[model samples]
Target: MNSNVIPFDFDGQPVHFSLDGWLNATKIAARLGKEPTAWLRKIETLEYISFMAEALGFNSVPGTELEEIKALGTSAPGVKKRILELSKSTGMVRSRAGSSGGTWLHPKLAIVFARWLNTRFSVWCDLKIDSILHGEMSTRVQLDRACKALEDRKSQASQDGKGLSSWRWDRSSLEQSVGYWLGQVQMTLDLDAA
Candidate 1:
């Protein structure tokens, strides 16, 4: 799980995306001050309502059926199974349990959830998730690459006897290296933010 996880932060809280690009819905829900199970149940309720409306016609649901649907909640019978079916069919939402467990969602549902939480948050979530899905490198990864490149440059230079002394005289080269790395970092950040 760790091998496939790509983690990022929003509003200072950590969120993760799988290598296949599934966003960790649980983390985002927590960041939004929502309970994952309750939210899922809400989603299930909406799905059930939509199905009923389509089947029975909107505003034509029988009173008893409407009441039963309204009563559907976290403890509703077969709700988990229905949710699982929904996940299997649509691939939009998923729930995992135990350690490393949380609801994971496709970017589409995640954006919807974010919108339900807050408009600004939804926009941020949309951009971030879209960036991840589009294969943009995370800022952390970009920074790491830049740092490693700089280290490699220094090490290669140090292999010669001059070492630090060489850098003192080769100030232009050093400056160029620093400028390149800084630009890389900036470009990565800008891309991720986009």
Candidate 2:
């Protein structure tokens, strides 16, 4: 496993990697030149309602929806109700109950949150997401290529009349090479192996 990558299993498919500590609100806010509190408040406002509508498959904000959303309170109870509604609709955002509790947004929603913060931050999030998505496939391809190369090297060595001890040495070398290649791949993909 690479120290730089944190693997999260999504839907029990190929492991997804998130850059270490990528979701800290403070860090995101700092990057966007906004206070975390302000950013969080913005998330709870119109932006959140917009996300809910889109998540619920509404192409456009439904009639009077914006008015209703605006009318919704921003007090704790109001926020809690909204979070519950959103959870029922998409299950993508939630509010925790407790002193340490705060609203939690899925990565996709976090990206939307970033977009709400600033256009530059939004673009950055998009690139990061794109990298994660494409990096998985690229890393797999590189690993496959490395494995094939190692196999070819071993076959060539055998064809050259390598002795048993030589074959064992080659195997050891192959293991080390493949290990190193995998480490590089993991680093490139920002992924930790499961």
Candidate 3:
């Protein structure tokens, strides 16, 4: 319902997503009969945190600093602040409150959550998120682009004195032949019926 949230049809279910490809982890977790907090707890491990930090373009913290960061714990004020900092700096995870409010995860991390949820769902999540991030084209649009490219190539070939004979066709003749064949088939069917 929030203007910032976009509704996505995911396998017949509507899921909210942010404009920058942040997936609504809360909604997905609920749909999958799991708690977002539970999954969050699972991923909050040092290994996952370090991987996420690096994947999000953050430099690896030194050993002592990393230990200090780990000590902040899930419920600590520092942990909340750190989550906010990570959201602002790296767009890793975010939470908001409203009708559409939920814990949103970056596409990268969303796939991790999906993998944690279900394998098939994870593959679908990966592809859907990928298409969202990288502008998906309709099959018709792709076909049109391919046709245009072929047309350009054909034109070049004609100009180079290597024109393709098979590419030439009489559209009117083709249409007339198709129409006549259809009429003949219809008449035969009508006669058989009578």
Specify the highest-TM-score model's number.
3
After superposing candidate 1, which stretches have Cα over 4 Å from the reference?
43-90, 135-194
Tens digit of lDDT per residue, candidate 3, span 41-141?
A: 53153346456767667643345644565676667655645544444344466677888888888777788878888898888777666655564334324
lDDT of 2: 0.53
lDDT tens string, model 2, 1-194? 13333443222323222342233334345445665455444425445645654776643234364456556655635664553453434544444454323454455556766677777656766665666555566665666677887888777777767554477667777778778778876677554464
Badly placed stretches (over 4 Å) of model 3 are 43-46, 58-91, 136-194
For 1-194, candidate 1 gives per-residue lDDT tens digits of 55456566666766677656677777767777876556555645446434544554343224554456557744788855555444334445566776557877655566666666678877877776666566445654655565666677678677876666765666566556556655664464333221
Give TM per candidate.
0.50, 0.43, 0.53
Pairs that collide in candidate 1 are none
Note the residue pairs that clash in candidate 3: none
Residue 169, candidate 2: C-alpha displacement in angstroms:
7.7
lDDT agreement with native, every candidate: 0.59, 0.53, 0.59
How displaced is residue 136 in candidate 2, in Å?
Answer: 5.3
